[model samples]
Target: MTKEEAPVLLEVRGLAAKAGSAQILKGIDFTVRAGEVHAIMGPNGSGKSTLSKVLAGHPAYEVTAGTARFDGQDLLAMAAEDRARAGFFLSFQYPVEVPGVANAQFLRLAYNSIQGARGRDELDPLEFDDYVREKMKLLEMAPAFLDRSLNTGFSGGEKKRNEILQMALLEPRLAFLDETDSGLDIDALRVVANGVNTLRNDDNAVVLVTHYQRLLNYIVPDYVHVMDGGRLVKTGGKELAIELEARGYDWIQKSAA
Candidate 1:
């Protein structure tokens, strides 16, 4: 398909997921197109994170039914690593720390892995260093961060920024940011938002799973969806988020009830 005729980047039809015997997502349906930023906002335990994991093919959660298509390809059929190499990036809310791995080395390995999967020439350390340094500047991260162990002693904000750094490096076609602004301060929030803004292009889209409207203020979404009881209860533009913020979710809960 040409750029104009390219299918939706993401299309979920009656998607349901379960963790062990417990059902988390119940018949969720949504479609995201290129050049769009879609925000999924809801109260706690509303299956926001579950949706992200299921899309990225997390093994612990089983996709009980329904279908998810990414750029006209079957996403569920792809392996987790294959999904990443195929341009699916997930920014975890809680980034893990590696005790002895240097941040630079980890990034180089990830970049090279993606390149290898795409059948592109792998860059040596020297080549990758220059590429990653340019990305770090886009994130406003210091050069010193490259030498430190991955999130070993970094602050919460630092870890989130590091996640964005990975996103920038990977440059996925579709990015799922699960609660990226969870523990960020004002300054860090701005930095992270800026990085996301810079990455926004007509060729990619972002699915932002968030709880607060504050983050929306920074990276405005074209569509805002409210999920409840494992299903999407409402969808609208940025104003919907403001409305929900102004009038708590009680009305939506009552309406659903």
Candidate 2:
């Protein structure tokens, strides 16, 4: 058929989560097929980030109920690192800074770890340098970026670009980007969006979690899912994002009601 009709990469059903006593992600059901880009938008406290973290298998939240399958494997059963090795990636909303780790060193370690997990020989430092630099070119990052401590002293746009670089190098099958557009200017947004678009293919999928539709303008999604009251209230095409931009999320809650 078509790339748009590619097989499923992620299937999440009846997903419920809780952070200690607080209930979040009451019941999230979504499907991400290979070659599809899905955007999840909602207001604050709506559990968008929570769902991303839960799927990534973060220890802070417990999966009280439900199931997720990544390429036919039980996703919830895998550890966070295993999830990454299994081609599941989550880009944090707040990419943290590492004080002592060189960016190149960190990226190489992460890349090699995934390769080792997949039963492949790790790339030597010299080999990885050439490989990583090629991926950096996709984000227009400078060679000096590899020398700095990871994310330390990086501008907001720089950190986001660094995250995209990780996504590019690892080449995960499914990626969940949380608020990647936050704190980015128009030009940076376009660059980051273009980098993500370049990585799109019939074997991977992207789920973007954001609060604004501005990013959607750069990276158009095949589906837009509205989140409210800890669940998905609506699903539509790219036009849904424009509608939310014009009318705000209240319009979705009202429409869902």
| Per-structure clash totals for the candidates | 0, 0
For all candidates in order, the CA lDDT equals 0.92, 0.93
Give the range where candidate 1 is weakest over 10 consecutive residues by summed lDDT: 1-10
What is the per-residue lDDT of model 2 for residues 208-240, given as tens digits with 9 covering 90 to 100? 999999999888999999999899999999999
- lDDT value, residue 166 of candidate 1: 96
Instruction: Give the local distance difference test score of model 2.
Output: 0.93
Candidate 1 clashes: the total is: 0
- Top-scoring candidate (TM-score): 2
In model 2, how large is the Cα lDDT of residue 178? 95
Q: Clashing residue pairs in candidate 1, if any?
A: none
Indicate the TM-score of model 2: 0.97
